[model samples]
Target: MWTAVLLACVGCYLLKLAGMSVPARVLDHPLVERVADLIPVALLAALVAVQVFAAGPGLTVDARAAGLAFAFVALLLRAPFLVVVIGAAAVAAGLRLL
Candidate 1:
């Protein structure tokens, strides 16, 4: 067990060294930037959809769906984060329980 832990630590350190030592030129490509730009939008779309409609394997639409949709629109309009999360949660909980 001790040997395994030692090997794991060394392996992780080497991996980190390799990553930090990579030349800046490789990361300066426009393709890398373009992909980075698209990643956030794609991730956000996935997260929002999952939060709104996901209850299990198959998609669902319930109180959470209505609340999340409203929150999305509110966020697009520059509403504060706390306001959106709380408002959406409130609406969802209310619809679900009351």
Candidate 2:
């Protein structure tokens, strides 16, 4: 497990390095610029989805999902980031307590 973790860390570092090494001309391409702009948002959404719904090898519909739903609503309502986070956590904890 430690070896796998080490390898993964090294691989991630190398991948980042490779991205940094790309020429400015390539990065300046219209398509590349668009993709770069959107990549972080896409990745964040994927990560949030996974964390909210994944349970080991299967998917779950639990308090975390409820929390995420509340968070989404809060975002749509233009709530502050701290409010969004607290609201989500409160919802999840409230649901779990019931």
Candidate 3:
């Protein structure tokens, strides 16, 4: 397991290094810039969806779902980031405590 972990880490580092070594002209392309700008948002949404809905390789809805809903509403309302996070945590904790 340790060997596998070390290999994976090395592979990830190499991949990152390869990306960084790509030619500046390639990275400066307009399409690449647009996609790069959007990648973080897409990744974050995917991560949130997985965390809020996945359970042991299956889908489960619970306090996290509710909290995410509240967070979504807060975002739509233009609440501050800190407020959105705190509100979501409060909602999740309140639901779990019930």
Candidate 4:
């Protein structure tokens, strides 16, 4: 397990280093900059769609939709991260209990 963890950490660090080491010349290209800008938006859209609409593979909202909405509200209100998480969890629990 320790070896596996070490390997995973090393792999992650290498990926991060590679990301940071991208040459300015490469990233300065207009096409590269455009694509890079879109990448984050695409990723965020995919995440939200997956979390809110997904069902299989243990990713479904099921009875957690209300809680997720509440969490979004908390985020809009600039709540702390812990409060957002706990508020969502509490709402989810309350929903599940019904």
Candidate 5:
């Protein structure tokens, strides 16, 4: 276990070093720029999907799904971030209580 942990740490350090060694021109390319800009959004969406739908080894659609749906509608209506989060939490909590 310690060996695996040390290897993973070394791998991560090498990956960071590789990223740092990338040339400026390569990083400045339009395609790279576009992908870099969208990576965070894509990752966040994936995380949300997993969190909302995954339950252990299977999938689920429960109060969490309803909360996500409510949040989506709130976003469409231009609700503030705090309002959206609070509204979603309230929805999931309310549903779970029933």
Candidate 6:
């Protein structure tokens, strides 16, 4: 177990070192800039999808889906951030209570 952990740590350190060694010109390319800008949004969407829809070895469509849907509609209507979040939570909670 310790050996595995040590190897993982070394691997992670080398990966970081490789990223840091990338040339600035390569990093500064327009395509690289665009991809980097969108990566976080893509990751966050995937995270939300997994959290809302995944259920153990299957899929789910329940209170969390309701909450996400509510949030989406709220966003479309230009709702305030706090309102959108609170509204989604309230919606999910309300459905769960049913």
* Candidate topping lDDT: 5
- If the candidates were sorted by their TM-score against the true structure, best first, what order would they fall in? 5, 6, 3, 2, 1, 4
Q: Give the per-residue lDDT digits (tens) of candidate 2, residues 4-98.
A: 99999999999999989999999899999999899999999999999999999999999999999999999999999999999999999999999
Compute each candidate's TM-score over C-alphas: 0.66, 0.83, 0.87, 0.56, 0.98, 0.94
- lDDT tens per residue, model 5, 1-98: 99999999999999999999999999999999999999999999999999999999999999999999999999999999999999999999999999
- Candidate 1 regions exceeding 4 Å error are 1-23
Show the colliding residue pairs in model 6: none
The stretch of ten residues in a row with the least summed lDDT in candidate 5 is: 51-60
Off by over 4 Å in 4: 1-23, 29-41, 57-61
lDDT of 6 by residue, 4-96 (tens): 999999999999999999999999999999999999999999999999999998998999999999999999999999999999999999999
Q: Please, what is the whole-model Cα lDDT of each candidate in the order they appear?
A: 0.88, 0.97, 0.99, 0.87, 1.00, 0.99
Candidate 6: where is the Cα deviation over 4 Å? none
Q: Lowest summed-lDDT stretch of 10 residues in model 3? A: 49-58
Candidate 1's TM-score: 0.66
Pairs in steric clash, model 2? none
Winning candidate number (TM-score): 5
lDDT comparison, 5 vs 6, better candidate: 5
Model 2 residue 15 CA deviation (Å) reads 3.1
Name the better of 2 and 3 by lDDT.
3
What candidate 5 gets wrong by more than 4 Å, as runs, is: none
Residues 5-77 of candidate 3 have per-residue lDDT tens digits of: 9999999999999999999999999999999999999999999999999999899999999999999999999
Candidate 4, residues 1-98, lDDT tens digits: the string is 99999999999999999999999999899999999989999999789678776778666656578877988899999999999999989988988898
In TM-score terms, candidate 6 sits at 0.94
Where is the poorest 10-residue window by lDDT in model 1?
19-28
lDDT of 1 by residue, 1-98 (tens): 99999999999999999978978887688988788789999999899888788887888889988798779888999999998999889889989997
lDDT at 84, model 6: 94
Among all windows of ten consecutive residues in candidate 4, which has the lowest summed lDDT? 55-64
Q: Mark the regions of model 3 whose C-alpha exceeds 4 Å error after superposition.
A: none
